[model samples]
Target chain A: MNTSRHTRIRSIAVLIVAALILEVTTAVQYYSTRSSVASVIMEMAQRDVSTINRVAEVKKIAENALHHAVPEVERLFAQGDRDSLYRVLQQIVREHPELVGVDFACKVGDDGKRDGYFTFRNEETGGIQDTIIGFDYTERSWYREGLKHNGFWTEPYMSRYYVILMSTFAYPVRNDKGEVVAILGADVPMHELSAMTVQLYENMNHSLVPVIGLQLLGLLLLGFIMFRSIRSVRRLSEVSAEKDLINKELDIANDIQTAMLPDSSQIHEFAGEVSGTQNVKDCIDIAGSQVPAKQVGGDFYDFFVRDGKLFFNIGDVCGKGIPAALVMSMTQAVFRSVASKENSPARILQDMNVIASQGNSTGMFSTIFVGVLDLATGRLQYSSGGHDRPFVISGGALRQLEFKPGFPIGIMENATYWDFETEIAPGDMVMLYTDGLTEAMNGEKNLFGQQRIVDAINASGAFETPKQLLDTMSQAVAGFVCGAEQSDDLTMLAILYKGNSAADFPQK
Target chain B: MQITKTVENDNLTLSLEGRLDTLTAPQLEAEVNGKLDGVKTLIFDFQNLAYVSSAGLRILFMAQKIMNKQGKMIVRNANADIKDIFTVTGFSNILTLE
Candidate 1:
C-alpha cells in the first residue's frame, strides 16, 4: 500500500483498539461499581437488623425481671409492709440502671385520707419515695388495663423528665376477700436501642470509601487514553500534509522541465527559411502526441532560422523524467550555438556530436535529425544521427529518403554526418518523425507503422497550403490511434515547399 | 513581425510586438537563438505582443529549454486570455512567470 493508506489503516487500528479497551474497561468499572454498591447496601441492612435484634433482646431481659418482681410486690402489698416494698424497689433499681423508676398505688379512703402508703425508687434521681395512692388513678389507662387483666405491659411513653420509658408487667394486688385493690408496676428506659442505631450508620459510611475511589480512578484512566489517541491522530494528519506539500513541489519542477521543449504549433514559423521576397519557405507542420510510459519521456523537437537557413531538429534522448528533460534542454542550446556558425546541416551535426560527446558523461545518447531548408531553391539538406528516415510524397507516390545511419549524438566526438539533398515541389510533402508515431500501440498491441502513415498521407487530398497537409496528417494519426494511449512522445514534422506564386495562407 | 532584444549582466530580455504565431515565430526564434551564447537568464516581455498560437508556444518551449541549461527563463505581462490558455493546457505549471 501507499504510505498514506498504510498510515491511515494504522491510525484506524489504533483507534479501534483504544475504543475496544475503553469499552471493556468501562463495562468492568460499571459492573464493579454496581456489585460493590449492592454489597455495601446489603451489609448496611444486615447491621440495621442486628442492631434492632440486640435492642429487642435487652428489652426482653428487662421485661422478664420486671415481671418476676411484680408478683413479689403484690404479696408484699397484701401483707401491708410498705417499708419492705420500698426496699425491694430500691434493690431492683440498683440491679438495672436502664430502668428509670418503679411505683405502687393503693386506693385512699372516701374522706380523702391516706388509706395505704405505696413506695418506689426514682432510679434517675437515686431516691426512695412514697405516696398515699389516690382512687383517681383508677381512671388512668395503665391502671384500668392492670385492673382488668391479671398482668399487663404499657407502650413506651415520655416521662416527666423527658426520658423514654415503658411500664412492664403491671400486676393487680388482691385484697383478703380476693377483690382487686391496687396495681404493681415497673418502668424501663430505651437508651441502649438509640446507641445501636447510631453504630449502624457509622459502619455504612466506612464501607462506601473504597467503592467511590475505584470509580474515580476508572474515569481518569478513560480520559487519559482518549486524549492520547487524539494526539496521535493529529500527528499523523500533520505528517500526511507535509508529504503532500513535498509532492506538489516536485510536480512543479517537472512542469518547468516540460515547458522547455518546442510545442507543435510553432514548428512552421521556426522550422524553415524565408526567400529574398521575404516570404516564408519550407513550412513544417508537426502533429504528434505523447503518452509517457512513466511520469515523463525524452522526446523533443525544435526549429529556428539562422544566417538565412531554416534549422530544424527532432531528437529522442535515452532516458526520462528530469534527467532527460535536462539533457534535451542542453541539446537545444548546443544546436542553436552550432547552427549560428555553420551553414551546412552535416557540419552543424558534426559540431553538435563533438560537443554532446564531451558533455554526456552518463554514456547517454540521442537520436537526432537535423535539416536546413534553402529558401532560394526550395532545396532541403538533411543529416540523421541514428534517427528515422524521412517519408516523402511526390507525384502521388510514397518513398523513404535513402541514407546510411550515423552514430547517435553524444556517442563519438569525431562522428561524421553526410549531407543529402531533396527538391520539394509545390505540392510535395516531407515528413520527419520520431519512433513514437510508428510505435504507437492500440488495445491489441498493434503498432501504427510507417506503411500506415504513408497510406494516410496518400489518402489525404491535395492541400493548397502546408498547414492543411499537417492537419490532415494529424487527423489521420488520431484516427489510427483511436483512443489508445500514446506510449511515447509522437512527434512529426511535415514541410511543404510552396511555390512563389501560391496564394497567401489564411490567418487564424 | 518584430522582436527586440536587450542584454545586460548575462540577462537577455526580449520584448515582443506584433503577433507571435506560426506566421511570425521564425523572426523571434532566429533572433533569440542566435544570441543565446553567454546568456544566463532570459526574460520574455509579452506586454506589446498581441497574439500567440500553438506555434508560438513551441518557440517558447524551445527558448525555455535553452535557458534551463544556462540559467532561467521568465515570461512576464501575459494577457488574461493567454494566461487562461496556459492554465488549461497545463503550461502554467511548466513556465516560470512573474
Candidate 2:
C-alpha cells in the first residue's frame, strides 16, 4: 500500500487495539464490581438474619422464665396473696436480663376491696407492685390473648416509655374451671440488632476504596503511552516535510543555472553575423544530428561582439548540481568582465585566472577556450586553459589545432595563458568541444575519441552552416556511445572562416 | 548613452540618460573609472535611463566593489522595472539606493 494508507491503517489498528483493551478492562472491572457488590449485599442479608436469630435466642430465654415463674404466681393468687405474686415477678426479671419489664394483670371483683392483686414493673426503674395493676385486665391485648389461648406472643412494638421492645410469650394461670384469671408477659429490646447492621455497612465501604484506586492508576498509564506515541509521529511528519522542501529548493536552483546558458537558436543567430562571407563562412556544413541529454550539465558557451571583434567562449565546470552551477555563473560573469576590458584572449584569461583563484574556496576549477575572430583580417586569436584543442577541417582533411596547455582557471593565482594564431584560407573550420564528446563511452567501454570526431567533421563534406557541424559531431558521439549513460558535461562550438565576400563561395 | 556629471566640493553627481545596456556599459564604466579618484561620494541619477541589462549590472557591480575600498556609491531615481530587478537579484541588499 501507499505510505499514507499504510500509516492510516496502522493508526486505526492501534486505536482499535487500544479501545479493545480499554473496553475489555472496563468490562472486567464492571463484572468484578458487580460480583463484589452482590457479595456485599449477600453479606448484609446474612447479617440481618443473624441479628434476628440472636433476638430469637433472647426471646426463648424470656419465654422459659415466664413459663416457670407464672405458675407460682398463680398459686399464690389462688391463696389470695399479693406479696408472693410480686416476689415471683421479680425473680423472673433477675433471671432474664435482656427483658426490660414483666407485668401481671388480674380480673377485678365487684367489692373493690383488693380481692385480687396485679403487679407491673417500670422497665427504667425495675420497680414492682404498681397501684394501677387492677386496671381492667379484659381490655389489655396480652390479657385477651392469654384468656383466649393457653399462651400467646405479640409482634415487636415500642414500650410505653419509648424503648424498642416486644411483648411476647404471655402465659395464663387458670383456676380449676379453666377460665383465665391472671396473665404474665415479658418484653425484649433490639439494641444488639441495630449495632450489627451498622458494622456491615462500614465493611462494604472499606472494600470499595482500593478498587476505585486501581482503576484510576490503569487509566493514567494508558494516557501516558498515548501521549508519547503521538509526539513521535508528529516529529516524523516534520522531518519528512523538511526534506521535501529542500528538494524543491534544489530543483529551483537547477532551473536558474540552466537559464544562464545561451539557447541553441540564440547561438545560431549569433553565428549568422559571420554568414555570406566568402572564404570564412563556406568552410564546411556538418548537419542533421541531434542528441538531447536528460539533465542540464555544467557546460556553457556564448558569443558576443566586443570592440569590433567576435568574442566566443566555451567552458565546463568540474562538477554538477548546485556547486557546479555557482561556479558556472561566476565564470560567466568574470569572462564578460575581462572580455570587455581586454582585447587579447591571453590577457583576459590571465585576469580571469586571478579572480577565480581568489574566489574558489572549494578547490574546484574549470576548463575554458576563449577566442576572438578578427573580422578585418580573417584571423583567429585564441587561448586555452587546459581545455581540448580545436579541430580544423580544411581542403577536405580535418586536423587538430594544437596549442600549449595552461593550468585550469582557479587553480593558481599567477597562471599565464599563452596565445596562438591561425590563418583561415578559403574554407577551414575550427571545432571546439569539451571532453564529454570525445570521452563518450559505449556499453562495451569503447570511447568515441578524437579521431572519430575528426572523421565525422571531414565526412560531412562541404556544409552550409556551423550549426550543422556541431549537430553532426554531436550525433557521431551519440552513435558511438550507443545508449550509455552520460557521465560528464557535453559542450561544442563550431566556427567557419568564410573569408571576405559571399561571391567567392560555391552555391549548394 | 549620455552621462551628465556635476561636480560639487567632494561629491560627484552623474545623471544618466538613454539606455544603459551592453553597448553603452563600457562608456559608463570608463567614465566612472576615470573620475573616481578623490571623490568621497558618488551619486548615480537614473532619472532618464530606460533599461539596464546584465552587462549594465556588471558595471554597477564593479562600481560598488571599487567604492567599497575608497568611498560610497548611491543610486537614485531608479525606475520601477530596474528597482524590481534589483530586488529580485538581492542587489538591493548590497547597494545604497533611494
Q: Tell me the deviation in Å of residue A281 in model 1.
A: 5.0
Runs in model 2 deviating more than 4 A are: A1-255, A263-296, A502-508, B1-98
Inter-residue clash pairs, candidate 1: A255-B94, A263-B58, A265-B54, A265-B55, A266-B55
Best model per TM-score = 1
lDDT of 2 by residue, A1-508 (tens): 2564566567667777777777877787788788888889899888878877887788788878877886687788788787777777777766677776676766445654332333445656766434454445455577668667777877666555445556656787777676777677775667677677788879988878766876886697589658756964875576567667866776676576666655534434444444444322233222211121324455667666543356778776655545656777889989988898788888888998899889665555677888987754557899887666777777777777656666567766787788899876655767777766765668885667777986786687876667777767777877888778875667777766656554533332
Collision count for each candidate, in order: 5, 14
Q: Where does candidate 2 chain A have its weakest 10-residue lDDT segment?
A: A283-292
Question: What's the lDDT for all of these models?
Answer: 0.67, 0.69
